[model samples]
Target: MSPVTYADIEAASQRLAGVANRTPVITSRTVNELTKAQVFFKCENFQRTGSFKFRGAYNALAQLSDRQKQQGVLTYSSGNHAQAIALSGKLLGIATTIVMPQDAPAVKLAATRGYGAQVILYDRATTTREKLAQQLASDRQLTIIPPYDHPQIIAGQGTAAKELLEEVPQLDLLLVCCGGGGLLSGCAIATKSQPNQTNSPSHHPRVIGVEPEQADDAKRSFYTKKLQTIHNPDTIADGARTPSLGKYTFPLVLHYVDDMLTVSEAAILRTMFFLWERLKIVVEPTGALAASALLEGLITIPDTKIGIIISGGNVDLQQISQLLK
Candidate 1:
């Protein structure tokens, strides 16, 4: 059996009730007209901590044992997950220590600390965040809640897709941004396992994970059926720069996802700005990955109800201004 199931997601939904935001299933007439398809955007940018990572973080932290809660928790993340863990810990009254990259977005870095978590910045070239987290976890006797690997995290993240599917019926395709595959795999499980809500020929929507071309490990892993890795990729999508899929998420993604796709840095930025100006949604580059694929004509499935997950809205305005320079 899979480590996480649709039932687990459903249960997580109950646990997260009144905790995690249902987010929004938003439709853009401009987007639909441009694509010539029914496009529903699952806007997780409006989620607590400004990202869907809050769902998994809160769900995982909420289930900690009484002793574990007292002892505290530790984690490593680039940005979104860091903020998620920090905010969740604050709400749960659990102490949190986060090891983050020195180069993580300033906005995210400030927000993580703003939630009352102690932030330890590390040089990505000098040491791996994983090793730092492990050492700190052991020294502090703190439980480790990985950003995307645990069953509870996966189950929690699946709730986003469950809500999206519930709001928008009969999606022919589902595009999700892929980092370590927590969101992608979790969403895929919720989507593929769903019974056909329409009289369509397929059992479920075709779940496709979108990644930056610079960080194509997930794409390579999907096709080769082997775990892959990437170093610090030079891309604007900081959120999708994860080295590879997690142990739990890899298998889940391979089983549940139909395919994986990659988009360029240019496409990501273009889509991000387009959403900002046209759709009036503040999307970071990572948030634009899935939409970029569709908008850039990477895939053309016409006259279908397609669901695209906007993973986050957290962006460093300074960095964006610098890019504009």
Candidate 2:
């Protein structure tokens, strides 16, 4: 696996400075009271395209040559990354084609089309989005922008942490949800670059990765000490349903991530509701995974400064009534 250096992440930060939203770090006295931790919520749900995927998408697109841009790009994503790549491709005057599961959230599918990308839906249970994406890339001669595997994408995603640490440098733990490990890998890069960003000389902020127990590939990977893959994982956190961690991202997470933990589907749903009611934030289940870990006491954040990434808000409203009930 190639090393995702701090320099690569810094370069990505500079490339994305103008394109990505430098979203504010929001804190609440209420959350502080509840967790007994200095809670800084980096609200990427408010980001353009409603997620941090835009930072990486734009960063990768920006690096493409004019000829390559004209040739267009392709990607496979469940939702947030699809919309991010589609929107960024449109903004950069590049055509995009996205492969998504037929059952992806309606809000996300619609948003991807709204960005003018041609969308192709496949079977959620059997059809392989990766194989489809590869075929399309080969047939169309399109540049494949992987959701979480590429160096530029990882670096772009890391910029969010770079900005967060810029605002709050004393974070003791950074909790992020892991799907394909893009965001966590990026966060590791960003936090590792700063002096004393960790609790001590040899440590950085404990970068804890949260995942639903049903689809906890990162957790399995961490424990088994191998790059693990899950076949056809079914989870309500659609955004967290990645089949495996990327080859490029696995080593980084293995090296930098302090720990991995799992939360139940009920915990995810409950936290989703909690954020909606108490925090007044419309966090999708995947976005709320880290908070779910906290709420369930899966990891102790007690009295330490904690950073939780509110990853995205692309929830299907049609399903809300059912989920709420």
Maximum-lDDT candidate: 1
Model 2 TM-score relative to the real fold: 0.96
TM-score (C-alpha, index-matched) for candidate 1? 0.98
**How many clashing residue pairs are found in candidate 1?**
0
TM-scores vs. true structure, each candidate = 0.98, 0.96
Counting only residues 3 or more apart in sequence or on different chains, how many pairs clash (N, Cα, C under 3 Å) in candidate 2?
A: 2
Model 2 stretches with alpha carbons more than 4 Å out: 196-200
Model 2, residue 105: C-alpha shift (Å) = 0.5
Q: Please, what are the lDDT tens digits per residue for candidate 1 over residues 84-192?
A: 9999999999999999999999999999999999999999898988888999999999999999989999999999889998888678899999999999999998897
* Residue 263 of model 1, lDDT score: 96
Measured with C-alpha atoms, the lDDT of residue 170 in candidate 1 is: 78
Clashing pairs in 2: 198-204, 198-205
lDDT of 2 by residue, 1-325 (tens): 4467778878888887667788878887877887888889999998999999999899999899998899999999988999999999988899999999888899999999999999999996788888999998999999999999999999889888888888988888888999999999999878866754554646567788899999988899999988888887878999889988988888889888889989999999999988888888888999999888887777765878899998988889887777767
